[model samples]
Target chain A: MWQKLYTWLDERLGLGDMYANLLDRPEPKGNWWNTLGSASLFLFILQGATGIFLTVYYTPSPDHAYDSITYIMNDVAFGWLIRGIHHWGASLMVLVVFIHMVRVFVTASYKYPRELTWLIGVGLLLLTLGMGFTGYLLPWHQMAYWATTVGTQIAGSVPFLGEFILKALRGGPDLSALTLQRFFSAHIWMLPALLAGLIGVHLYLIIRHGESHFPDEED
Target chain B: MSGSHLSRRDFMKAATGAVGGVITAALGIPVIGFLIAPALREDKAGAPIAVGKLEDIPVGKFHPFSFTITKVNGWERTASNYGGFILRNSEAPDDILILSSRCTHLSCTVNWNESANAFLCPCHDAKFGPEGQVLDGPPPEPLGHFEYSVDDQGVLTIVPVELKSEA
Candidate 1:
């Protein structure tokens, strides 16, 4: 009965073809190092889940923002564990993504047909850091406030457009309620949207080129 | 013989399904609780805050005053600063108006500009009149007010919640 149901659904969904193309494809023998890409993907999914859970209790306003997070950590059931996973997941994702890049570089996987993949990977790395930067301020704590103040100030010191960039990032002369609001928007919406889109393209490119074989003495 | 009937491929498939189910439950159950806990809890309101002595505030002029509400949630304690303008309309204890200094546009603190006779928000250049009416700038509405009561000793106390004011 189950087999019949699966066959019927598979015929409509092209499930067999999808499984063959997406999962059962050929690849060069991979070592433990090859697991980093999937590991990063896992961490990204975990972070996304935990972050969504956090937003249920998190407030963007300066008034209740810190207290709200404190409530999450102290009162909410399993909130600490979820937040802990997300907090540590972010650091681990960055490390894993960077090491994945290094592994690709060492293997010269960015050569030729896979250059676009490398480029998208670089974009993903940047968006990940952008996520970190924007998420840091949501708590509205003193540390997050001052760090962002210095961070945006550095951006404002650019050559000619420094002032504009500073104002654009800060939404004004200095970090205020608007800064916190905008950062919340970017962290949860804008950057994640871009990252998700870029990740789709990155994964497609990897599938297209297949995992590049580890380079040997071959020219 | 009986054990040999469980082929390696079948055994692997069953193992994978079990592992996948375990992983899903491991993260899913706690996460659901985490997301729903806040909704299940009761909302706590701030206690009545005493701003200052009503006798000290001059009549017909807005005086700046601030108060801090410290909240202890879980293991952390945070003190949030809130300020407003107090206008003692007359010698009558009940005849007074208190307006929050928070700019309606973006919650930036507005300052009383004695020269301009208006509360000016530094962040967006918003201005408010003596009655907390929006005078100029991006503020969507007038400054908010607080519910207050004056005791026999002329001590003015206000509920910290910002109430919307018409006009």
Candidate 2:
């Protein structure tokens, strides 16, 4: 039964073989640029862990939110550090993810068998950027407030669906306390969960598909 | 440069080249630093802050007394806008209320109306009962409160709270 469970899990993840193959194969031996990808993963992990700690004390209500943040930053043990990790880690992830995408593009690794992997990678990249943007406003400070208010207003500027997307984001015609609550919930849960699943699929695709040949492959 | 003559050793060197030398020092260090800066920064949270004199606050009137706070939020240093309000009680000599200027409705500025005996929101005509309860207008709920203290010097001090806005 245990063997069966292992097999079932192995069949789903297949990550061990994927790692073996990637290492045995030379293309993924990787270079300094590849560290950015590794760094990105590290940042993601940092975000998730610190985010959990933050949730322990975070009050999502509009009334208590700013104070909750103040509590986290000032009152809690290393609260500011936790928030900083979550904050800076997010920006770092965004930067590295973009650099990874650019590397893939310049190398033309997006072609052929890697197309699916690249597509998922691009999707994940966009998701990372969205995550950064959404999380920025969570602090609910003067900058976060006005910036997000302007951002939502920009979204509402789109023809037809503008108001819809804006309303969906803000949870109202005018930005309200509800808007803050909704964004907070989605930032901590919805977007992260989606990114996690997508990242898993992305990793699986990379493992199965293997690394694309670099431009120097023939040389 | 021949297509067929590359050795595994040469390939390995080429592969790791991007992760080595100048690039490692120039990019890797900063990348790590940037990612970790937030966690590395310290905060002055829980540190008691001193505000203004309790005697200076005139009876039956509100005065805005602000305290300078040293705050470390993630990688940035934020110094201003920490103390927005330190409302002195109408009748009590030392009673003070620290109300967030933000309206409960949309986090806009709310001022104390001595005549109306309420907090008035200029953004949407919202009114709050003297104690920060919602009285009339668009504010979804009562206005918020800031943790406050009257110090030994009789200074009214308020801890700065984050302003809430449309998510």
Candidate 3:
């Protein structure tokens, strides 16, 4: 019954061909280090999934934000574990992406034909940092508030467009409900959209160029 | 497509999917439950909190009062500090008003200015009069008023009210 169904779908959609192309690609001889890229991608997906769950119960207002988080931690079943994974996963994603970049750089894989892939990877890194910064303030706790104050102040110091940038980022002279709403939108919508687009390009380039061959022993 | 003949790859593929589905269900059920549990829980109501004695606030002046209220969210209980002002109106001695210190514009804590004779918001310079009415600056409306009652002993009790945003 399953074979019949698979044959019918494959005839119409070419699923078998696509699956073979995706899984049976050729690759360089390398050690465990090659897995870091896949690991980073996995972590990114995990973050997106967990973030959706958090948004279900998170109230973005200052009055209820902290309390909502407290409820998530204490009241929801497995809330602590899910939130913990998301919180720790964010830091882990950043760290793994950084290491992956370093690996690419050390192997000189960013040179020549692979330069566009390297550039797209850089874009992904910036988006990841943007996600972290915007997400840091959703809880509306004291630490989140003060840290955002300092962070925005730093942005307020830029040369020509500093003041405008600060106001745009915060929605006013101070961090208020507008700031919370803006950050939440950026964290969940804008940054994710940008990251997904860049990941698509990055993956396309990876497949097009093939994984950079491990450095030859003689060279 | 003979039922009696199963290739090793086909057998492995079926086995892999079956095991993966089982493992996914084992993990996914608890996570889905956790995500939905908060929405299913009953809403916890806030109770009236005792601020202090009525006499502590002098006549014709606004005095700041603070108290901690235990808020229950789901299974977690948290004590959050709530602030308000007690005013003994000299014009209407019978009318005592308790106003929340949060500003109407941005919800920043408003402090009473003795020299200026108004409540000032440090964030955006919004000002409110002693009776909690908007005096000047960027505040869209008057300060919020909390529901309160005084006991026979003159102990003032205030209930925290969630302010409805005008904007």
Highest lDDT model number: 1
Q: Order the candidates by DockQ, highest first — what do you get?
A: 3, 1, 2
Distance from true position, residue A152, model 1, in Å? 0.7
Residues B89-142 of candidate 3: C-alpha lDDT, one tens digit per residue: 763434788888888888789999999988999999999998889988999899
Query: Model 2, range A38-106, lDDT digits (tens) per residue?
Result: 567767776787787677667776666687787666655556666776777887788889898898898
Chain A TM-scores, all candidates?
A: 0.97, 0.85, 0.97
Error of 1 at A162 (Å): 0.9
True contacts kept of each: 0.77, 0.00, 0.73
lDDT string for model 1 (B66-154, tens) is 98767654435767788888888888888889999889999899989989988899998999998889999999988888889988888
lDDT tens readout by residue for model 3, A42-150? 8899899888888777888887889888888977888887789889999999999999999999998998799999999999999999999999999899889999999
Off by over 4 Å in 2: A1-29, A217-219, B1-167
Q: DockQ for each of the predicted structures, in order? A: 0.34, 0.03, 0.35
User: Which residue pairs collide, candidate 2?
Assistant: A31-B19, A32-B18, A32-B19, A74-B45, B52-B155, B54-B154, B103-B108
Candidate 1 lDDT at A179 equals 96
Give the CA lDDT, 0 to 100, for residue B66 in model 2: 50
